[model samples]
Target: MAQNKNALIRYKTIDKCLQNRYRKWTLENLIEACSEALYEYEGRDVNVSKRSIQLDIQMMRSDKLGYNAPIVVYGKKYYRYDDESYSITNIPLTQNDMDILSETVQMLKQFKDFSLFSELIGIIQRLEDKVYTEKNHRDSIIHLDKNEDLKGLEHLDVLYQAILKKLCLRIHYQSFKAKSPSYITLHPYILKEFNNRWFVVGRKKQKRTNTHLGIGQNFKHSVEP
Candidate 1:
């Protein structure tokens, strides 16, 4: 794992170097950048080998990792991408990847009848739908549920992630009875849907009682701690 991480860091550094059209990139420059990057991440001076970087460039320039980066050398000394806009991180999804995502999402959705998995189905559906839309360049085909007038649906993904990651959130919300919105630090626990409406259940900071709030006009939030 350590070796893999270091190689990943070196590859990123090399890609960054090739992306800078303003600078004349050399092999030594890339090696130095990789060494610096690893040192910053590892908190120690790491010795980046010339051979390793050479192999990394070779690997990036090949189709083995699906990058097939257009690394070119002009003046026989400087290296840059032939296509300046290409990067390994932005590779388009392949057919196999799409198949795997479809299968996995469908499998998970099959268990949504169980209470433990009900609230998260919407989140997973959005993820799959997003991937599909990006891949197909059209609207999502797998429509799960339609609640067009639903409030706070835009914040569902972040709230769900916060609950799963055990993080706190500071949300600004105005209830039906309140005259103005107020901020509260929340430790999100569960998301529940009833009657086509969503509620977030959690405990507020410095409070013992658990509270459930209707998803309202909560447009801004921050982590409590």
Candidate 2:
């Protein structure tokens, strides 16, 4: 039963199933309850078998899941886990989930040349393990990019800090079409990139008024600074 792909559940599912069961559970009934709950939670079908349920019962009984899960024979049937509340963290992952996470970790390691992202592979490995083991799949599909290399790194960092602090900046910027450099005071609001080049989006100080600059703003008024 452990080798079957269709019969595995994490520890949290087991805890929720037992909590939802108001009365005692026979082996057959418990298996049914677990399968149904798993289907509702994960939108996946799980086939519950007697042998599989027996092994689950044994694992629960070993105090491995923080429950003194006991087997009781009433009218010649096996029942287990009489406790009211159990933690989901006590659940273990199926071997398949572990293998999939290991493969993903290997892929993340291929980009170790990026210094800022060096530890990201290990972080993801730990996160995958924690999710599968605890059955905490609430925000499971989330991902992030850790790459940090970019041109004008220090200037970009200063712009970001100014935006976060709601401060204005006076910049000396050299424009390709201009004969000389330009000085501009800008209230930083947003930053964007296009064609591998960075751009600043904000309100620029104009000849008698303040004008907002963005992707669609007039090019003549959008001086680089």
Candidate 3:
């Protein structure tokens, strides 16, 4: 079945709720949990009905989606996973899924000649290597950019979430010329990377913002705001 983004989110929420063996999850509780999770992730209130949760549980329990979650009801009301280690995320990709991904990689390889796609070439190669490794049961042959050792790399997810939620952020930043770091309020617009270094492009939250500054000039300041 082709599931919408919201439906997939609800399924994941239900899976997480049922995975918590310490909590006795009822139908009402599951609905409330799913509603809260959707609100937090999507930044909006979404009504999660009893029927929706029931359908999600039914789908997870079936082989239709390959989840086949061992969801069981105890005390005739509370729901829990029969196997504690069972998780929808832990499900491996099927052979058909691998075939589709391999084809996609091949298609993406055709765009490597374009200048716009230069940055993504490394990412595409990494994805191709990952698929090859999973399918062949061996290590990856291609070595791409590994940013695991890069400084301030951990903040990517939080910055991404802030941008998605349309939320302002207080950033503590330091420049090489600056003696110390300063905190500034920023309305994050986009996250960009150039020359293997990550930077956030956004307007500073200030009354007299320096909008006339060029992109290269703006990066020199200790705190724009």
Candidate 4:
């Protein structure tokens, strides 16, 4: 559901490996396996290499994917989840991977200040957990852009929920020129980002004004509807 490149590759590897029990695959085999799987799923062949698989393993170990299964090697044979209290498949994630993922989770905490929808966060977390890795790969990894405004995430989320539900909202809008916060009821129809700032396009209920909120409204007025 989430269109993360690293996460998708990891998931495909794990799924492909799990689908075949008697089959033992090296990194090379896993790459081919994933290539075939992608061809079947995407209706096109996507080129894959050992480096990509290695990165997938790194990402999974980074714990962003939340899987911790040990693929064991016996002489020439390779198998995952041989014997443990939790099957390798059931391991959830390796400690290292969990640490990385935990850091990711922590980074997301910057949005905790804003209004958020429970369902949206749940969906994001679920998708985040599906990432995995293969034999030759190091682990799965994801790096959020650091120079981005993480705080605006909550505002985006609130706007998204309002738009999805078609619900009007009472928002405390701050205008830089006004020097004070003003309350307005808005029929939030869309959320847009321009120049890295988010805007809520809606109709103001009080003034019955059709407004496009982009660079921040300086003058404050109330919306009735």
Best by TM-score, which number? 1
**For candidate 3, which ten residues in a row score worst on lDDT?**
210-219
Task: Report, for all candidates in order, the number of backbone clashes.
Answer: 0, 1, 0, 27
* Ordering by lDDT: 1, 3, 4, 2
Comparing 1 with 3 on TM-score, the higher-scoring candidate is: 1
Each model's lDDT comes to: 0.80, 0.53, 0.69, 0.55
For model 3, residues 51-137, the per-residue Cα lDDT tens digits are: 899898998999999999999999999999999998897787788888888898789868867775645554554566567668778
Model 4, residue 141: distance off in Å is 34
Model 2, span 25-77: residue lDDT tens: 56767777778866876687867677877777677667665444544456677
Model 3 scores a TM of: 0.56
TM per prediction: 0.58, 0.33, 0.56, 0.33
Instruction: Please provide, for model 1 over 101-152, each residue's C-alpha lDDT reduced to its tens digit, 9 standing for 90 to 100.
Output: 8888888868867885646656675667656666767644333335444556
lDDT of 4: 0.55
Model 4 error, position 38 (Å): 1.4
Model 3 root mean square deviation, Cα atoms: 13.6
Better of 2 and 3 by lDDT: 3
Candidate 2 backbone collisions, by pair: 11-91
lDDT of 4 by residue, 1-225 (tens): 623653485565655584466776677777777787677767887887778776765554455555544445555645343443433254545557666765765566556555664324433433243332222243322122232332344455456555655677777777555667777778876555555454667888766667766424342332335
Q: How high is the lDDT of residue 146 in model 1?
A: 56
Please list the residue runs of candidate 3 whose C-alpha ends up more than 4 Å from where it truly belongs after superposition: 1-3, 118-126, 136-225
Residue 209 displacement (Å), model 4: 66
